[model samples]
Target: MEDELEDRVLHQTYLSFMKIVTRLTSSAPHDTPVSYLWKMVRLYFLRSEVAVITLGIILFIMYLQTIEQWSRTLLSRLSQAMSPISSVQRMKFMEGSEADKQSWELKGSLSAAYAIKGRRMHMEDRFIINENINNTGISLFAIFDGHGGEFAANYAKDHLIQNLYNKIVEIDAFKEGKIISTPTKDNAEDKPQEPESNTSVERKISFKKSVSTADDTSKKEVTDPELLAQLSKARPIITREVRPTKPIKNVPVPLSSYLDKGKINFGKLLTDEVLAADRLLVEAAKRSMNVAGTTALLAIMEGNHLIVANVGDSRGVMCDSRGNAIPVSFDHKPQQVREQKRIEAAGGYIAFNGVWRVAGILATSRAMGDYPLKDKKFVIADPDILTFNLNDHKPMFLVLASDGLWDTFSNEEAVKFIKERLDEPDYGAKSLTLQAYYRGSVDNITVLVINFLDNKVASSATQ
Candidate 1:
């Protein structure tokens, strides 16, 4: 009974107070209302000093909340800048556009790929299928498997191809009319640019072409002959070739190129571009709270020539004319002798936990991002580049995929599976992912199959 009576009295008092407040605001002088409000506020809260303390706490919490929200928005904007889908949508806005036509034209060559977020919370893999790049009859297909997040993969997919194309054009490879013909000549010359994955490379490429200094005291110069800045936004830039200080000749041009005496040294092109992209991407990632890394496996088909650049565990295999499987990319594992030695040289170690991992955090030794590891040289982004001429190998089809698919399928097994289903609408890409999922694969699965039966055959006559 006492509680009910107290509640009723409090409610009545509140109603009377509101009426007084409304009346005073409407009729009383402004100064009078201000004084009245101040007195009323003191009268209500003076009974308990705890009320003032509580109000102060509430205001401080609100201030902190505002700051946190503002920071979240800022981080999101930076993340969006890494790979802006809105910009792409704006560029390719119309249907049946040039980009669309080119995409279909490449699809007509019987290339199909599919990605699925299988057994993973978020799908981090990204892939690209582009054809007739710069009207040079060059087609590029790539797969990027992200480990920690998708930012590194997406950034690489957006910038690496453009950078590589600009580098190729910089060399006058197409302007000079160097055709890939039989009895090819690979000058085996040292590239006139900075070394591949030079440790001292500035982690940043300028928006405009500018000279980078190595040491002010020594007066040494480090220049990217290609300018190394190929982002679309950078329009006006200059290019100057400096005599290279380092010579890269240790890794020989691979088996197919040597056997056929391949002409162009695409190795240098892939090396320089991938290394530059990795450095810039690392810088971008370091700014964010989430630092990631990705494996890159890229294939460039120009005329009769095919060049592949690989970093990490993603695999690419081709079916030769004899129906035998030929690997195009090699996986980088921490257990490998060379990789182990490099890790140790950099003051890092690898441990086996179901699989060999660099620093027990990453399974692949070479990847695009993955911060402080890259700083310590415990992990590198240097790619292994290999070249082949389609005329010499006569590939029936090629299969490229992330390690998820390779975990359950071998090179021969994948080639035979695709060969049997070459006529399928998806060129066996969908089926391959499904098969891997069924075969106990636990990671994200992505597969690409390019059938060469319908593609233009490269021969000496065509050249």
Candidate 2:
């Protein structure tokens, strides 16, 4: 009805204007030029009620057209801003000095960690410890040594584990503690296996023998804790070299019987979880996390199974009952053959600047942020995951630390130091961190020690 009325009104107004124009032109021969213009206006434009409706409708139409154009423009801009392909928001550097003067500590009945600024002016290191995940007998521990800034470390400290857990419980089997049984030999292909090598070191559980990876170490098993401690103090001190090898991909080791009261997948889907967490960080690094990067080492202990995922040069080593060190995770350095190949494949290069560095900037070839390199595929956040049955090592405790500690302390030296201080007030975490600082580590120092004594762990807060 309104449309019809509007059309009729416009049509009548058009006919009226033509009629008035024809009349004025014919009648204007008797009037002056100025008077003729006034007569034409009075006949149509100033025609009172009809003229008001016609002018009002025309003005309203103009307003509607303007609003329609504005709405379309706004919608188009919004679509471009929100589209994934068209949008690449960048992170901005913060103002003022973020260089920190800080030292920190975290202590629990079963775990403890310590950190300090060391020789660096800024403290860009972060750590996390969640002794129990939803009371499911699962514990989480991590250390992130950040570079460029603290943003990436902070982001991972806050979100990494949450991301891992969300990925873990996605399946009903894991959620209900009804994970499927281990695959049979006939179907062993269901899980990928490590490339076989005769030199592979397989850990075994025996308190009578301390598991040692050194080829030159004595074969005799030391049962006396006191004697082992005595010999550890007298043993030659050396940094253990990390040789990256293909990770063992299968094992629902029979040790699971005593490790847990309930059956849950033994770190199943953990690799996917680590990859998922890094993927998220990469996106954040590209957008808001800035160009900052961090070395991430996360350890999950469920029952007797200990699974570790690592990136960058941060280190993790487990001490056996006999006080020897067994590495749980290997470092990813640019000089590694595989790492060099990947960098070369991506059209990037590494250089030695005091230490081997990726593109002469980052010391490690793998990290959680470092957008400058991650974007170029020279540095990655993909974790090299390794799993171990704590039962096999007859483990005493685990020491996970940043490269800052590794810079000053070797695997053998650190294991011996911590084993001697495990019963101290800080459980060796604080002592080891101070030791690294005194030994002249140039980077930020962080150390985490987790004790497996009595099969007990705790949920603790960082201080």
Candidate 3:
């Protein structure tokens, strides 16, 4: 039994020794070729992942920097574009106006030309107003072009309509006062007193007057009662003579009647007001350092009457029911022969190859402001106002736009485009302006399209 226990203990010791050898071989570090290849492969993958993460971080930072730079550039461009008309300005008479009582609706759009580089720039400005009073609707459209700088254009855009409003008010006041009669030394004393309120004044006198006169100076020859019997026997040899008649004198009608009869005297009013305003604008322009000036085209539609006032090169186009564009405003520039002749007659010489410049200072013969050239006697700074009554058909659309769009498209072309787009279901004024910008208009383009469609149609179309 002792021998059997010894054999079993020895077998146990041998098995324990073999287990210790196996553990030592497994724990020992090995440098076998296969193990080294596996370690190399694992390290290579880790390095690649770290490299990709580092590259991704770098790209993200670059993207952020690029975005920041791009934002700054865009903001700078916008700022430069708006630099010219940054000054504070006010309109002359936009306040205290009654809203339109009519049911008509008005809509408009505007755009700037393409971006320009450096000091030279192109810009546009526009204004529109709709007024309804006593169920009568009035719409006003205006465009202004800034030369030398956009300050003048902006000023005109903000104020020209107000000036027209003031002029209209003046006209209303004149009509209310019955001041149509020419002031004479004798009638001056008999003139009616000014009424406290405009509406309280007496109705204006009839423009026409009738004249009647009678005189009993002479009669046909007649024989006396005693001689009548003798004359009858004498074969009635007496003859009768009559004096020649003279024309009766009639009183002249009052001038205001012409205006009251739907004849808008825009020419007279614009002549008076624009000249005065031109003088003021010239003075103000002189005070400014950059010699700012504006080109203006203004239009007013009242009933069938269309009044147009223009200065410089801006334009007003009228589209009839047939979709034909009619130019209402005349462009005033040095290149016009009549303007050139006027300039030459006034002792002003044309420079730059007969461009009709005033002392070689200005390119336009007629403009609102250019104090440097104002001293020239021949320079026409006053606006030309033209008025006409439309045929029974109302205007389909009236376009008031800056020169940016006009430079590329003629009045007819613009009207045609607007008309064609009008029929499209999704057409919009803003979209048309954007398309203009896309069509190579490199300046600030502003367009005001007045559609006289019904409210429901306009609302639906806009939607």
TM-scores for all candidates: the values are 0.58, 0.58, 0.52
Which residues of candidate 3, in runs, are more than 4 Å off? 1-126, 133-136, 158-160, 173-264, 288-290, 352-361, 392-394, 423-428, 452-463
Residue 106 local lDDT, model 1:
19
Q: Can you tell me which runs of candidate 1 are displaced by over 4 Å?
A: 1-108, 168-264, 454-463
Ranking by TM-score: 1, 2, 3
State each model's CA lDDT, in order.
0.66, 0.66, 0.52
- Could you tell which candidate, 1 or 3, scores higher by TM-score? 1
Query: What would you estimate as the lDDT of candidate 3?
Result: 0.52
Which residue pairs show collisions in model 2? 204-392, 259-303
Over all chains combined, what TM-score does candidate 1 have?
Answer: 0.58
CA-only RMSD, every prediction = 20.7, 27.6, 28.4
lDDT of 3 by residue, 262-370 (tens): 4446666556545655655554444443345567777666655677888877777778877778888877767678888887787666566334444454556777654
Candidate 2: tens digits of C-alpha lDDT, residues 98-178: 232256777755888888877774577788766655445566788888777666776676555554443333232234534
Off by over 4 Å in 2: 1-101, 167-268, 457-463
